[model samples]
Target: MKQREYYFDNAKFLLIFFVVFGHFIQSFIKESNSIYALYKVIYTFHMPAFILISGFFAKGIYQQGYIQKYAKKLILPYIIFQLIYSVFYYFLYGKSTFNVEPLNPHWSLWFLISLFFWNMMLLLFAKIKPVFGLVIALLLGLSVGFVDWTTSYLSLTRTFVFFPLFLIGFYMKKEHFIWIRTKKARLTAITTFIIVFIGFYHAPSINYQWLFGSKSYSSLAEDPFQAIFIRLFFYVLSCMMIYCFFACVPNKQYFFTKLGKNTLYVYLLHGFIVRIFRVSDMTDLVNPPKSFILIIAVSFLLTLLLSSSMITSLAQPIIELKITKLQQLQKKWSNLFQGYKAKLFE
Candidate 1:
């Protein structure tokens, strides 16, 4: 069956907005108000939902066939950005770096690794036994949740927990997705919002961590089931929210659509932008004024505008590089498939 793709434009922007806002709030804590409270509430739902959206997108890609196609598209960018930031990190912290590096594995790059592994795993195991694939994912999640990141096992959990969620997003009940894709999407989103908002009351949000603290903290912690339960609610809300946005969004303007296209660029650049702002001591932004409402609004506007502009102007070469690599990967995969047909009988 041909999958019904949902473009839900507004949700894409909303997710991007939350992503920008969440990072800004966390980074500029010196200036923040109790407003951090609201950030925690929003984050509970944001990431899991984003993972699901990727899964939904993956459904289309899977049907098309895995080439070095998705890998080149995903991995080439990962390499470009990792090396770019590796240079950046070396310059910034390598000056007097300690024995154990703060982000040696390259923290931002974790998402790419997790995504690649998840995609590969799905491709290999899913066709033979979907349940087995799910079981493997569950085991991976469990290991990360309970096992230590620094331990002998190199696999990390925190970055990969969303693998299962990513799968769920791609496979949906047509009836349910249709209901969400319909005009009734508003109420669907509203219900999801309500559920996640309620979870905020019980969700375990990190507040006191030191700057650039170990992301391994996400590996595992207390009340695993509760966190998972909360994550479940947030995941639902995230999809509904996405559906609602698409249903209500006006025709795409060149500006916003352009921004969405370069979301990867924005995600990469914003931290540095935030750090530069932090160093400048502008707005006395540290211990910023109590109007979090205004602060968050301005932060979103500024990050989106700056990141998008920088990506278009400065990162064009990398963009071309990504396309070239993707094409090469497609060619390689096509050749492999054509030259080596599946064996007829063992």
Candidate 2:
């Protein structure tokens, strides 16, 4: 088996941590300017960087059964989670009626459906020259905003809006990432992050929803035509922030590095905890400044917990449609039990 690169793994773990942290602080964005700025800063890159990395690994599109493979991997889990979240929200919100609109993905589930689409898109987009493909993708992404109907239903908006990054990632070679890891790039990345954060802190009028890429220009601005420029600006900003994020990711492996492979588990499972936290009075307790430190710690711990073998083992069936991890975990416990029994008998 080929060895996994620690650099990508490190990048994934860090990005997923940011994803969790971003979701945790979202409830408090309205109450704290600093948190709001941080939220904007995070949203600018987290998902885009993730999508780019996802694209980077998508070089296997030509392999046999690739489409079928991802369909089972992404679509199956998306369906399962869509139903789960629907039922979860039904009970959590105590709604008058139960509704399951698979078209409308709940919260963070959009990534699954959109990811599948991005891979499918590579069938066509990958055929074009990289530059032309990217330009076409950008134009399509910008044009889609005018068609007000291109909302989040089936994640169509984001599928197009973010496809350029995905295409860019697909075209990227290993050497490109190696170049970003240079000391000069790291310094530039740190400076970029600081400047962006400060800029966001001062520019409260810049709506964070622009970073979401979910809404249409019609809804977000007075003039749809002008909003295209705003969306273009964000596309540029997101790409810059994405490379900056990549530049900062350490290439060395760490304790949490292996957990990066299980990010799907974290992405799918963390929602339950975050949703419950959002609805509960817990948000009131996690006020900004000092409390945010606690939120950060909790986010890291939550990411760690969800990525642990035990959680992955339990969730393997639903998420991966496999029990290999579960069986290993079961055998591990059985061995421990047998060892304890032998000790007692002795």
Candidate 3:
């Protein structure tokens, strides 16, 4: 068996925690700008980093037959959870009747749809040179800013905007992450993260729609040229912070390692729980300091609980349909062979 790169697992654990934390903070987004600022900074690099890491691990999918299994792994859960959340939304918030429209994502579940596309597309991109793929992804990202139909449906804009990060990850070798392990690099990453946080805190209220890559440049009321530059800047900055994040994350085996393995479950299931809060108005923070501390703590705890093995074990039947189907098929074949053998002997 191959050794597990604890570093990647560790990174996934951290990113998933932030995903839950960020969603939790959305409840308080209207109440506190400071928390919103923190949320903005977290949003800036978290998904990009996650997608990049996904690309890294997704290396050689074409050769490895990984793509063949993605439908069962990603697509099924995406459909199941999308419908589940749709119903959850309809009843909880009284939106409409349960509806499952193609290409239209339900809230945080958009990542699954986006991931499905990226995984499938990477097979085509993998045939090209790394530099060429990177260029293509960057250009597509830039051009996506000009198109108005890039937002929402299927998360096309985000898929294109974040495609470069995924490409970069695909091309990165194991040695690329070596620098992050050094003491000097760790110090710099910490410093950079702190400085960025400080900037986020004092930064004026700015539209963060660009970071999500879901907005059209025209919609933002910026000229095409300026929008291109802004997108380029964010792309570079996000890459920097992604590297810094890899540097700062501990490379050792930790308790969260297992949680990292089951992130799909956490990512898919936690949304329902979070939605319950969103509809119940439980996330609203009335008292700033008191609510902030309590909510953060609860959110962190809830994230961990959702990612726990207990929850994963329960969800396995739903999320691991391929495994279940394979088991049933195996049993059916075994029974058939037994009957044939018995009849032949008789």
Candidate 3: regions farther than 4 A off:
1-4, 322-346
> Can you write out model 1's per-residue Cα lDDT over 201-312, one digit (the tens) per residue?
3443543321111223344354665555544443344445555544444443534554554556666566666655545556464454455677678667865675555444
lDDT of 3 by residue, 77-132 (tens): 88887777777777887765567675688887778878878988887898988888
Which ranges of candidate 1 are over 4 A from the true structure? Answer: 1-6, 28-34, 60-65, 97-104, 128-136, 150-155, 173-176, 181-188, 191-255, 286-289, 303-310, 319-346
Model 2 — which ten-residue stretch has the worst lDDT? 1-10
Candidate 2 ranges beyond 4 A from true positions: 1-4, 339-346
lDDT of 2 by residue, 151-263 (tens): 86898998899999899999999999988888999999999999999999999889998898888887786488888888989998999999899999998878998898899
Give the per-residue Cα lDDT of candidate 3 at 94. 75
lDDT (0 to 1) per candidate? 0.54, 0.92, 0.79
TM-score of 2: 0.97
Pairs of residues at least 3 apart in sequence or in different chains that clash in candidate 1:
8-246, 30-287, 31-287, 31-288
For each candidate, give its TM-score against the true structure: 0.68, 0.97, 0.88
